[model samples]
Target: MRLNGKLAIVTAAASGMGRAGVARFVREGAKVAAIDISAEALEGVVAEFGADTVTGIRADLLNPDDATGSIDQAVEWLGGADILWAHAGMPGPASVENLDLDAYRKAIDLNITSAALGAGRVAQHMRKRGGGSIIFTSSVSGLVGSMMSPIYSAAKWGVVGLTKSLALALAGDGIRVNVVCPGLADTPMKTGFTGRSGDPAEAAANEAKLIANVPMGRLVQAGEIADAALWLASDEASFVTGVALPVDGGFTAR
Candidate 1:
């Protein structure tokens, strides 16, 4: 039990990597507050994991009030938090020509602002507990350029920068901050993004093109990213901080 006796808060916990993180953390003996904007989906998580191990929190990370309130509520329920996986994020318009200023701002808000607010709020609670770990979800696009969506690439890059800056500022408080940059993951988010072409043939072609770049020759599973998060959140990574760890199957290596 890598996380025995620990308590954690995971945002976007209703699905994908965030939901996987909740399941993995609980299996490792940690009680978790599963925060998501979807109350119905969150209920499903609590039901699946049992109330003893998972507490479902409904909050919109894009809203500052909801973001901070979710952390406060998680701390209240868990007694204290030892880990925070701020994994809520979204893909922006596929091309710069399609970009709208409002959409661009929303991308930044979802990818970076929410992370900053959550980390700040969680750090205060963690400092009282002596130390804790904070993890953010970036993308392979963060490490390299995304010809499809430069805005998303830029926002994710901001996340990596934020992780390093926060790591230094919070180190004296014994808190560790890190980000995970996953390569073309096999998740609904990926499917939906590719499907935006609105033509099944084109969508499949797009996916194939992206996968052709991965040296592993396949999409990275959501669970694999969750596993990386588990390592960062557990005592196994006690000495690790300020790292933008890429679980990108050699995409960035190219």
Candidate 2:
């Protein structure tokens, strides 16, 4: 077990990449506290993974109190946190032209602000334990412009900046901070962003458009991205820090 005797906290853990990440970490022998905004989904995770291994918490990362409180709750439940994956995110409102100002603010808050807040709170906890790893989920959109979602790209780019600066700030404390820039993945956010209708033909067309651009010729799987997260969280990546790792199947290389 790569993470045996470790305690991990994963945000947005009810579905998609977050859920897969929580499961991956637990499988590596970590006691994980999984957090999501949906209480029902959290309950489902608990039932599927068992309360002994996964502790589920309902938390809205956009809420200031909830953002920091989730870390506190996880520490209380899991005893301590050796790894923190701040991975909650949203697609925001379609394009920049149709961007809802309120939703844009929320998208920024959820994608970047909450990540910073969570990291700060978690850092405090990890400091007592001597050190820990903190990984933030960014996107290939952060590395390149996206005509479909500008605000989301902006927020992810912000994550890259935050991760580097935090790594330097926490280095003396033995903490490592890094960002994962995943390409198009088979996740709920991907479906919500690209899907326009329930029509099968329309869905296939949407997927085809994205696949054509990917160097791998298909969308990445959620578990694949979680694998990157696991490596960053594990001791295998001990010397790695302040990196924007593109788990994007060479999409950004083009």
Candidate 3:
């Protein structure tokens, strides 16, 4: 119960790492406001976690108002937020040759602006509460260049920058800001983006290629990434801030 008595707000909480983080936070004794764009999915999360431990909010974070609104709603319900996980992001269109300008813009909005905006809003409430922890999700692409997804790489790089800057900005208020960069993960996001096939031969080829660059010989898991976030949100990392911790199975090491 590292996070006992804490209140947290997590974006993109309906699936993948965000959903895992919500569950982890709850297990550690934090009341979570799970914000996602899918109303039905949020309902499912509420059902799984029970209304007492989690409150689901359907919000399109692309709209600036909705991003901050989600945090405000958490404050109203949970009283105030001590842990802010700005974990919402989209891979966008991973085309480099025929760069999709629209996709790039949307990626920036979803991955960079949304995280920064949400963290800023939550920081205010945390400041009033005396202290807090703010965690953002970046990617291994943030530390190194991504050949297949330039726009996503740029957006995640922006997250790292934002986290460092915010850490210094909010340090005086006792708010710690950090980022977690995950390597290829076996999550709904990864499967959806890769279009994983059921064919045995194709699946083998895909798995091989996916782990080729990972020194650890396997993909990271959503739960592992959640553990990193949990540590950052807990008192164990009380003196940790402005750090970009990569939970990427050594992907960025090589």
Which one is best on TM-score?
A: 1
Q: What's model 1's overall lDDT?
A: 0.93
User: Model 3, which residues run further than 4 Å from truth?
Assistant: 192-207
Full ranking by TM-score: 1, 2, 3
Q: Give the TM-score of candidate 3.
A: 0.94
Pairs of residues at least 3 apart in sequence or in different chains that clash in candidate 1: none
Q: How does model 2 score by TM-score? A: 0.96
Q: List the residue pairs that clash in candidate 2.
A: none
Give me candidate 1's TM-score against the actual structure.
0.98
Worst 10 residues of 3 by lDDT: 191-200
Separately for all candidates shown, the number of backbone clashes (residues 3 or more apart, or on different chains) is: 0, 0, 0
Where model 2 places Cα greater than 4 Å from the true spot, the runs are 196-203
Model 2, span 17-38: residue lDDT tens: 9999988998999999998999
Residue-wise lDDT of candidate 1 within 4-104, one digit each (tens)? 99989999999999999999999999999999999999999999999988999999888999989999999999999999999999987777775688888
TM-score of each: 0.98, 0.96, 0.94
Rank candidates by lDDT, best first. 1, 2, 3
lDDT of 2 at 77: 95
